[model samples]
Target: MDVPEEHSYERVKYIPQNFFETICNDNPDDFETELKKVIFSHVDASEKLGQKSLEELIDYKSQVLLKDITLFQNEGGILNKDIIDLEKKRTATYRKSIEEGLSNKKLELANHQSNKPKDVAKLESNGDYQKSIDEEIKYKRAEKEKLEEELNLATKKKSEQKIKQSNLERISQAIDTFQSQYEKLKTDNEPFLKTIGFKFEDAVQVHIDKNAINTLVETVKIKIETLSDSIKPDNENGLAFKIIKLGEEITNLQSKLDEPTKRYQTYLDDISKWEQREQELIGAEDIELTLKYYEGVLIYLDNELENDLAYKREQRKGVVSQLHEKKRAILEVYKELYKPVTGFLEQYKNINKDYEITFDVSFRLKDFEEKFLNYVNQGVKGTFYGNKEGTVTLKQIILETDFNTLEGVIEFFDKIIICLERDRRPGQGNESREIQSQIKNGFYLDMYNLIFNLDYLVPYYELKLGGKSILQLSPGEKGALLLIFYLILDQDDIPLIIDQPEENLDNQSVYNILVPFIKHAKSNRQIIIVTHNPNIAVVCDAEQIIHVSISKTQDNEMSINSGAIENPSINSSIVQILEGTMPAFEKRELKYTLTKNNMHSIPV
Candidate 1:
């Protein structure tokens, strides 16, 4: 394997090249033949020969012949050959002159060597010269050692100076910190000291000395050490009595402070409780006011009951007109979404007629009265009446009656108020008497009943699907209808994730309705579906497919292998496990071909 020098492979023992190399080694003869064929195919003999020929042609074309031309012509003209002969003779003359100069140089070198100075000979023969040289070298060595000693001494002084400078800087920082702490403590305690009729400066002076801070620190340290030692088995008389007296004083002071702290905490607790009680009373008062307002409305209605009936009839006509307009808008939405619902349903089973959706408005007196009673009961429980046991029952106020007009509804509530006053609870204490008075005045029940009846007067709507009510459908059919409705109603391009959407759907329904819908919807928004069925994955032509395999060994250790569809091992596993071998795929292909032909043979 040819590994790049830039890569550091300490743990990676094998690469893809190693596998290929092993395969090649196992079949060396076949590998060698294939490698040689591949190498030789890239090498063209004709191209190689053409390259050589082109090089030779360029060299031949670059050569130039020397030609002599006459510059001037005269009678008995000087020929070109004569000029060439003269130039050759001149060249020979120059070469001979250079040779003569070389000979002179050789002689000069010999004469100089023979006439050398006597000092040069004497120095070569002198025996004391080597001794002198060794002495000088020894002296220089001593001088170097002296210089090194001086350098070491200078470095030691520099290091000592640096240490002294660092200690001075640290001492300066400690002094600054101490000064800042003193100022902050003084500022924080000044106000408290003033409130207690004590001077802050005098209190600080008793424990601290500003002029001699170091002495103060030393004194405090010595006191702490002495105190610690006296508390031990030895040194029984070392400031033990002073420590005991100070401790007794501290305990007395703490005892004195605890009384006020407890009082303050008690005050806070009582305040919180009172605040909560205040909120409850406020809620009760609001409920009473609401009930009073309802009572007044009922009285007014009772006084003008016959006269308002004619006015209510006109209002009902106008409300009906508005209700019709809202009904048309709802019908438009139903009409728009109904096609998708029917299209989805028809994918499983074809229907000759379209699915029908109709909306109707009508008054349900029984349901209205039940809801009115519930509202009244809720309002009563939300008031102070609920706090008392057996105060009143909602049924007493909500009577069952056939009221066809607005005047009849008001008269019914008026009768309820009169009965409540007549049957007011008899009490002895002031609190019970107050409750009886409130009941006599008509509590929140009157207002609650009036609001409930007014709300019930609004017409209710019923939606029918395929000539049947929505409540009549089974769970699966209802789910299908709702899913289709949401898909049609959703206009934003947000991703929708569904897990096992095909659980309640038949394969035919999944393939025809769900698959086609997802395919079309994917263009506008992202759809992610988790399914175990291959039909959904393959029919949808999913961009990416992941196959996860979990297997346990003999030791019950599970190992998982997950990869994309493009992986060779994953492709093999999918084909074997999901497609059920190659034969199944072949059978499917044959079936599809027959189906396609049958469809083509049918008339348009």
Candidate 2:
């Protein structure tokens, strides 16, 4: 059954990789339905048949419903216009909202300007001023200064008292130091009570046991008496002179002993009196004097403290009173300022509540209205005319609708169109050549979309390797493209053999799409390809190779013989060979096949 040629230019239904799954579910019960009913039915069926594989069922369903696989239609191409229309409407809506927001801001600013002076007056210098209050504040500050001076005077008095107390303490310490030193020296040189002479106790004890000193004293006294009596009896004789001399010497000795005894007794009595006085002072007098001195100082300090403390209390009371007055003045001023503003601002706030209505309701409504109009216009254009050229120009609508930013939109799309046009005609001088180049480029781009964009090779739920882009295709995509390439190359449906089909592919990506590749294309298709890598060759069967070569003739010339190698080993050939003349080899196939032949019938 041939398709009508007039209908050839009509939009072709692009069967997306997921079309089978979508359609089978959509038409599960009936092959055709009302347009609306069909859409609902498809949506419903996809949801219902959650676990079933649509790709698996597509083959059977295609046979039953659509007789020809290539003749089937897809709804996505027709939906592109609707998508573009909806996007335009949405964009207009956004733009309208932005315009509304700007208008609201402008309205807010205008309201703010109207109320600016009132707000400033509420906070101005004279707004809360009172002459009496200022005078009272000045008076209170003067009072506070007077009180501060009094406090300073009291502090000075307290400092003087502290200094006097420190002096008294130093005097008491000096007296204690003298007393301790005198006591320590007196103890080291103490006099004995029993001894008449100034002798240490150990020296006196040594003489007491021996009577050497007493015997000497007694012998001297006896001699002195005898001399005295002899001197009286023999006054007329020569012995009288000797007696008189002895008498004078005895008197002199008596005088010396008498003075020393009296002095020694006096020293002993004085020492006893001094020791008794020291004990009396330590027991009562010392404590009494010390207590009396400190008590006097403390009394003097208390007197000074009483004066200073009284002065400080008086000053603090005045200061506190002044602080209260100042605080009252400040509060009065605050009341004056706040009282007026509170009423004025309360009303102002109520009036301005909508003034600050941040939402640009006016502009927003305007924008939405404009957007709605544009959307309606675009919908009409899309639904009825299927044209966007001039049925309702956005510029005319923008100018008449008074939109501020429609020009920006026009400019943006204009730039995009310009860029597309430039890209379309890149890298050429002549217009036709440029157009041809662009067509070629478009074909290349379409090839990218067709092979890579078809996501059945990477189903949504299935796992996929990372870093996958059209530019970075997995081996499976490349192989599929190669299959497509070969299919296009051999439009007559001849079998194809591709060597090293996936030479530079990553392993994980290859594994992820291998199943899809086999299922979609390789499973039902006849393809033969060679690979040095075992990934492809290991999986393949039924391969043949022909190795051929040419050698110099025995008479210094060359000959050719070439034939198919029935079974070629991985390393070398055994079964068959090729023989041929020396020829120019340009491509991989040529490099592989072209060779010179020798005179002998040995295959090259």
Candidate 3:
């Protein structure tokens, strides 16, 4: 819709159809698909509008898609039996083919059974011949040799036994002669044995002594009975009990010692296990502590450095402003200076007599005046000048002299920032410098702020990247700024909440900036952006949407209905905007519209 250039720009609005038609619209399925396509288009457009980035655009597009998809389904778009039947037919065909293939493979395998390898035959015939011939001959030969050696050794041992028997007979004769002497020797040795308390015939007398010992035993038994009669029963019983108790005490002590030995072994094993566990825990603890400390230090340094950098930025902004003012003053002074020359050139041109000379004078004076003015406007930066009739041209002035002063001023300001950063860095001797990280954190956050509030922020970040102070932002820069304002109004448990965050953003910035921001917000938070950008709504999660439809009732009165559908994900603010504008949007013919006609109006 083209409009008069002189008139303010207005976004087109969407109007819902009447209730009866909406509830009974023909081609409801097609409408849903078309609406889905529209939502995706919006998302695509949002993405290309880079100010908002992909994340934000996706969020907005998701919401729009959800609303349209849901509405389409709620209006009676359903799964068709024809499609289901077709799918089942395809599945059956696939299954039949697979079964046929399996059957053919089984038949082929059965036919190929004879091709299977049989076990390799062993040389049983060779084994039978070897066993019956060579093995039998070798065994008989070995047995005969073994028997021959044994027979020879037995014959030799028999001869040696006979020789030993002959020597024994000679010794027996010598022993007979010594027998008589033995008796006398024994008689002499008997007296000595008695003196030494040993008898030569004690071995023979042992049995005889045993009988005498038995007689003594009987005599001792009689004496024991007499002693028992003399002693008191009470004393004997007490002595016996004391002896038994002592024996039991000794036995209990021995058992107690063994228990300590077992416990000591168990204690040693436990200590060894505990020590191993302790080592493992200690190692883990060290790593965990190191990570925590490093992370903590990084966070602290980031905050501190950012604070300092922000202060430095403020200081630089003050300096940049002063420099700008100085530059402006210089320009103003140059303008005033050149104004006199311009007046002279015009006066001289009017007074010239000769046509050619007059033209030359006019041109020379104009060139000089223009050149001087250009130089003055550029803060007296030196420039080239073309001379003719004692005057220079503006174009010529710009090509000759290099204005080093302005460059020097710019370089000086840049150095000031560099010096500030260098000073903020930790001492060279110290290893804990986080100045660089802090600077990055500060820059990233600042960049985020600009992205969120593109109406003001985009240009701000651009300026910073361009080596300009934040305070020196132009009006255009402010226009491109974007901001993401997050407010946790309540911390209590709740299922979902919708917010109209785009109310603060501009229409042009909305697609590239606000929509993406909304989408980003919704990605992390369950939000519904009431946007006309169908692109954003289409890609959103389908389960979270609640579609609200507006239509005229049978009585010709406007009405609204809400329902669930295939896609349920939507930003609540978008829903609210649509719901609120339902009546008004009914009068309007478009299928979509912004909430308020006012350019900067936000939801209340």
lDDT of every predicted structure (CA atoms): 0.43, 0.34, 0.35
- Look at candidate 1 and give me any clashing residue pairs: none
Candidate 2 structure quality by residue, lDDT tens digits, 40-124: 2223244324424333333223332332211111222223233333333223343455455445544544554453322111111
- TM-score, predicted candidate 1 vs. hidden true structure: 0.27
- Write down the TM-score of every candidate: 0.27, 0.16, 0.16
In candidate 1 the C-alpha lDDT for residue 345 amounts to 40
Model 2: CA > 4 A from native: 1-492, 506-525, 543-604
Model 3 backbone overlap count: 52
What is model 3's C-alpha RMSD?
49.9
lDDT for predicted candidate 3 compared with the true structure? 0.35
Best by TM-score: 1
